[model samples]
Target: MSRASPAERDERLDPVRWHRPTRGTTLRLISVAVLLLTAAAVLWFKPATCTPLLTAPGPTASSTGKAAPQSSTQNQARDQTEGKPAARAIPSGSVGVPIRLADPTALSVVRPGNRVDLLRLESDKDRTTPVANAALVLEVTGADDPVLGGLLLALAPEEAKQAIATTGRGFAIVIRPS
Candidate 1:
């Protein structure tokens, strides 16, 4: 046969192929499938939930003076099985005191069930004094108002008086560790 030009030789040598997908297309499909599987795994997986180690004490049956009486045999069985003395009932009567924070942004770090120490700020003397220690945070109010964020603290009657008294002089809260 006569020698053909390079362009003509390339055209004749090229094979007549059907519309087959390229390697890049196959790789793209595999990548999409892997991404979908990863998403499904993320959505389907669930973490185990555990109860708190130190939960607040529940209301005591002894408080109402209506606890069921157990026979001596039953009491002995319970004592042996439990291997511990009965816990004393927790005393209740906590008073709520509404105390304002000097910096409302500080309340963002405080949560209900958290304990705080209250302090009184003396503007005239430029001194800070402790008002109450380890006061329970009962409620956080005025959350919508950045400047009016107030705290409702659960305290003993005397402690409540002390916290409320410091409201006029301006108050600050110190978040305590659990």
Candidate 2:
């Protein structure tokens, strides 16, 4: 045969025919598959005792050895009976003795007359003193009764002073008229 040019020789040696995979390639693929199967079998068949990653601590006895006793129905009934009020007492007021006028709208009332200053006491520490130049209405019961007057007068000077000072201990029915 006559000698072919370099380009012709290259054309005759087809890349598709030269690059085909062989038996060695098939052996390599099989080896990889076997290795993967062996690893999976070892993981599945291995003897392992699985311990809990997180375990709760066991409960302990309370410091008080005895459990708290529950209240009985009978005990509750007895307590209710003992705490009940016997009766409600009525309230009274008299004139010139700082008779608290019943006025829901007014915060406090000043008794009319010389040295007649009935001040409504406020618990707020900032407003302990009566607000100056503020007008408030007084509500007073006009029913005449000497007993109420005597009762108010009978109170000790200190007690009377205290009663006049604040609204804490006074009868709830008696309120400064607004």
Candidate 3:
């Protein structure tokens, strides 16, 4: 063979440049894009068919309806057992006397037509006692009868009356005539 010309040698040694991408490379890139798109869709959108973990039950009838009658009966029995006697007021024809005060050693008198005040006083040991403060009124029982001397006495119902009457205005002090 004869020696090749310089131009021919240059043409043979030049590199071949491709204008379009390779089929395998294009397919791989497209597949990667598709995978990324599927992942994004899964993150952004949730399926409506999925059910919640917890659901509330529908309304039901009350459980306590049957016990009402028994509860009322129990309440009535409690009231009957705990009932106390009603306090009675001192009678009018009877005189009121202060019996026991906070201080047992002290003596105090509450005459008729006067007021008495009662207060609760507590001792050092936490025991409480009722103390009475009295006001006295002096009046003669009978003025016309010479046989019956004019005597300073407290007000009370007539001796013949069987029941005593309480005035109810002042503190209760029950006294018997001496």
Candidate 4:
């Protein structure tokens, strides 16, 4: 192939021509800018729910300086043992399982004494599978602060074992309609 003349080559190498935007470039740039702004707006205006429920120190009772309401299971345990202290976290035969949800905000609607269904968050598949159903909520902290949120559930010993086995993985709660 023949080389272009030096003058022609110089013109081709001009920075102005090299840096010029093509016809579609403006559209692409505007779209990207709009996307970024939209993302920022969503994050900024969205409810501030960032903290984990467990971040607060101490048991729920200590927070308000009141004795926690005893569940029927706890009462039964106390009765059976004749003045023995029942477990504070959960009823005698049940387990107190702590779980972190995949999306911390999802726990906002949960509350103590509510029955919730636990699901294992299958991140790879973008879907969750059931882990436990009708688990008793022992304590709840809505994720409105600054870290990953948590929930304390009172599950039967057997179901608790299943939930415990999946610890460190993401979990979510479903509040069943009464």
lDDT tens per residue, model 2, 111-172: 21112223344544423333212221222222243233211122334445555656532222
- Reference-based TM-score, model 3: 0.21
Task: Give the Å error, residue 93, model 3.
Answer: 68
The better candidate by TM-score, 1 or 3, is 1
lDDT tens readout by residue for model 1, 1-178: 8999988866874577467789999999999999999999999987665333222345334446875432234433454479532221112566667888887888777766688998888877877888788987766766668576788777788877776665355888889899
The TM-scores of all predictions, comma-separated, are: 0.48, 0.17, 0.21, 0.46
- Which tens-of-lDDT digit does each residue in 79-142 have in candidate 4? 4488432223455567678887777776777766678999987756777778889887776654
Q: After superposition, how far is residue 96 of candidate 3 from its true place, in Å?
A: 68
Candidate ordering by TM-score (highest first)? 1, 4, 3, 2
Q: Write down the TM-score for model 1.
A: 0.48
- In angstroms, give how far residue 11 of model 1 lies from its true place: 77
Q: Which sections of candidate 1 miss by over 4 Å?
A: 1-91
Q: Which residue runs does candidate 2 get wrong by more than 4 Å? A: 1-20, 48-178
Best by TM-score: 1
Stronger candidate by TM-score (2 vs 4): 4
